[model samples]
Target: MGAFTRPFFIGFRRINTYSLHSMRQFVLFIVLITGLVTGKSAYAQWEFYGAGGVRYATTEEIDTNGKPLVKEHGFLPGLEFKANYRRGDWLVTLGGEIYGGNLVYDGQTQSGTTFSTDTRTRQFRMTTEVGRYVSDAVLLLAGTEWDYWKRDILGRGTTLGMEEEYNSWRFLAGAQTRVLQASWSDIYLTGLLVVSSPEHLEVNFDNQVFDQANLSTKAAIGARFALEVRPKAYSNVSVESDFEWMRIGRSGDAILSKGGSPVGTVAQPEHVRKAIGIKIKYRF
Candidate 1:
């Protein structure tokens, strides 16, 4: 065992976070070795596991139908690596993970105007935590980390253009406990509370009426959770799944938009997302 053992974890959505992707690689590595060693390619004493994420966002358009004008989706790709070290009641977990993907949206309109845009999105994150043993099978963990991100928006036709940078101070505190220890595998559940600050240093479009830029920098608090199964002691394979909800800085009127005349009464409602995703990890 190297560090934090329970596969891996993830947190918050709206803005992309890097935890979930790292773990999937670890989970898959376990399965490949198990299949070769056991003669069966199916799940064995060692196994692999993961999940995928799908996100949706509502637009700023208002309607006589009382419906927001548009909606869109964001899909991200991520992976994880794990090395856990456990001594009876205490242990340390260290790992590195990366999330790479594109941010895309399809504008919904009350009228005939439909819009779409795509931007480059990427995040690199890593963490380390120390765990204090509570019981022979339980551990409480706490730690901190660093997260770096970059998002670029390129307008196609009538939409907006945005280029933003997000670098955050990441603080994590959490716990994991043994749920069941069976002959085949060990099951555990983990939860983490994360506090971070994301800054947007550049704005190219007006947040309100300008067709170029809109949206603000944000610092927020969020949470992450995961459930994992370890097939055997020192086994290379495992099964894990996770969920994360994140609130990035909100969308506010930019410098350019603030002074512009209200364009035909434009309105923006709150934007929220519930993302569920899956992935697989493989270790060499």
Candidate 2:
């Protein structure tokens, strides 16, 4: 497998430590804000919901030369939960989801060697947002989201596999509108623009635990869209379909290390992910 199997691992122990701390702080801040907002009015309206769905996700990594190096795609079952509080024209919402499955992996090396395997994948996402109803049918929102993903490629004969982990934070601004309303049903549409920062990736080769590489932080932009339908008959039930797309720019080169000693330089290629899902939710 040549370089593809040559134990390319990225070490991010210190960085991950700092990131975890920051993430905790952010979560705490969100909780504090939520408490403050909701405490103002004992009569604030509250809604809670849980959802289950299946998602199809595809991820691709490109080479420095802009050629595709690896592709992984799969369907995963997932669950989501959310809580919303509304007072007057203001809204506060917190939500999260977890999903994972085995993905079919296809990869090709620069020297034309090819391989196929299965990759175990897991992902989690959390979001907090505040919004205001601008009109009877329109709402504007701003939010922050944290995303985490991990993949473990199974080794094949004479070939080594590796594990990759990624973390990122995103800021989003969006608007939602009730597109259609009737006595029996309502349909809503939402669109969001997202900006991501401090993208981090860590890699570990199964065979060479001592070798590592670091990908420099890069910013990315993405978008999300959702369409939701609520049936009057059920009153508190809704179904939603959503799509998300993101691209992480190619990272700058960093020193590769073996046993804490610098060996050479390596850079992470551009990465892209796309996902679509349908979910049914029940609210109380």
Candidate 3:
């Protein structure tokens, strides 16, 4: 049985037959892959593997009328980590990463009417998973993220600092199917599903008096294609693709208004998005 095992099931990730790009839950899928590949406190050998690569990610606006609003692109950097125990075909795992792509947009409306500063897209991830082998060529994983977020308007065009933050949980599941295995090349097909809470965050404007509440939740489904090549000893390269579609909404009305007056508090704004990305990583 190799090192990893099959994850029983996770609904957040596979919300039907939809593609990952339609879900917007790519990071959870990534954690699923990292944990399982290194599973086995009982079934795997204590080992560490990593890789870094560059990729392209695109986000498009989905019209309420069932059309695409705008298309955008970004450049990205990615890394992978694995920690697990080995005992046979069953293994437990833990892993995480930080990744983001430059934000590319078209229509100004998509950027938000309250937009005062230019924002780009970025992401951070932390998670743990478990897997067991059902067959030599197939591996399944199930896990949850302690925290995850997709941030926008990270920094000024030249400075690299983020001012806003979002908080949420992620439930994920995935399957990896080995298509080819050669001394020089390895290829696999990966499928994933992710379900998340609407992310709510606090933004402190330059003035300390204005406190903005950013509360929302989202769910997405997606898939990926992975290609790996071993060109030399002690090194390997991996390229991956991600696609997702998502529905996001506030848990409750953000604020209450009475007679045109700000009264009570409820929730935040609601929106939907679809995105796709391709990335590469080097393993050492």
Candidate 4:
């Protein structure tokens, strides 16, 4: 009986050793596959980036009868900054931008009066996002953005001076992918969509201000496409070109009396905006 019991205990120890060894091998295999999926381990976790650019933005204001009341077009210089965090194949970014310019527009009143107005514009934008690489060269991101558009209409001599401001929040999604990659250079493409929430509007003229109290703001949509070129792998400098377009639904009262009184209701003015720009960015 002692000999049989000793052999049974020895077999149980062998089986336990084999099971532990197999478990270790399985865990190591999983680690190897995870490393491959992430591409590389994170080294630098944070980066700061800045950009400067020139933008040509076009704006149009339409009257109730669907006729254009004003078409403002001009070029502006802009600046932007970003803070970025990277881990494995994922990145998070926070950014802000601002631009201002002057546009000239020819206006025709209902009485066939032709006049010109100088429209000065200022815009501020803020954004936050998280992005992940779906492939070695492709990335997708979803984000949120806030935008403030301010327009000041100055008189061209005897005309009236007015101001219009629109503020909105947007839901954004986009994709970025490499278009060309070589030893000397890399080219990338990026596209974006922005859908705005209910906007807020403020208008001021002749010492009177009209805003959310008496006016309604509508939704807006925007799209943008950009191209980026990196000249060297070791350098953090890049050249970029962007084109964007936006359209906003009707806003404000079409018929505000000369006395600033609310008159019979008319269709609100519609807004359309388009822009193209080139920029340079440095990352550290």
Off by over 4 Å in 3: 1-44, 59-72, 105-117, 150-163, 206-209, 218-245, 250-252, 256-284
Note each model's CA RMSD in angstroms.
12.3, 4.3, 12.7, 25.2
All candidates in order of TM-score, best leading = 2, 4, 3, 1
* Total colliding residue pairs, candidate 1: 47
Q: Residue 95, candidate 3: how far off, in angstroms?
A: 1.5
Query: Which RMSD does model 4 reach against the true structure?
Result: 25.2
- Between candidates 1 and 4, name the one with more favorable lDDT: 4
**Residue 5 miss distance in model 2 (angstroms):** 1.8
Query: lDDT score of model 1?
Result: 0.51
> Which residue runs of candidate 1 sit more than 4 Å off their true CA positions?
1-74, 85-88, 108-114, 158-160, 198-201, 204-218, 249-274, 281-284
TM-score of 2: 0.85
lDDT sort, best first: 2, 4, 1, 3
* Candidate 2 per-residue C-alpha lDDT over 1-284 given as tens digits, one digit per residue, 9 for 90 to 100: 11254444211222346446645754665465456555645544877677899899998888768778888898988887777888889999988777889988887643457878877887878899999999989999999999887777777765666666778899999999999999989999999999999678776656575464446557999999999999999988999999999988888877767788887666667888899999999875
lDDT string, candidate 4, 56-128, tens digits: 9888777667777767788989887777778889989877777888877666543446666666777777788
Clashes of each: 47, 1, 53, 0
**What are the per-residue Cα lDDT tens digits for candidate 3 across 1-284?**
00001111000111122223322445565555556555635433664555465556554444445455445466667665655554577767666665665555443222232112333445556677777778987878777774444434322222222233456677778876787877866667766677775565533222212234344544433333444443334345666656655555434545533345564563323345454555555543
Better of 3 and 4 by TM-score: 4
Give per-residue CA lDDT, model 1, range 1-284, as digits (tens). 00011111011123323223434544555464345445533423222223233322221323336455434446677765544556657777665555667756555322445555655666655666788888777778887766655555555443444444445676778888889989888888888897765543333332322322334445668787878777876465566677766655443545333345433222223333334455444433
Q: Candidate 1: RMSD over Cα atoms?
A: 12.3
The TM-scores of all predictions, comma-separated, are 0.59, 0.85, 0.62, 0.77
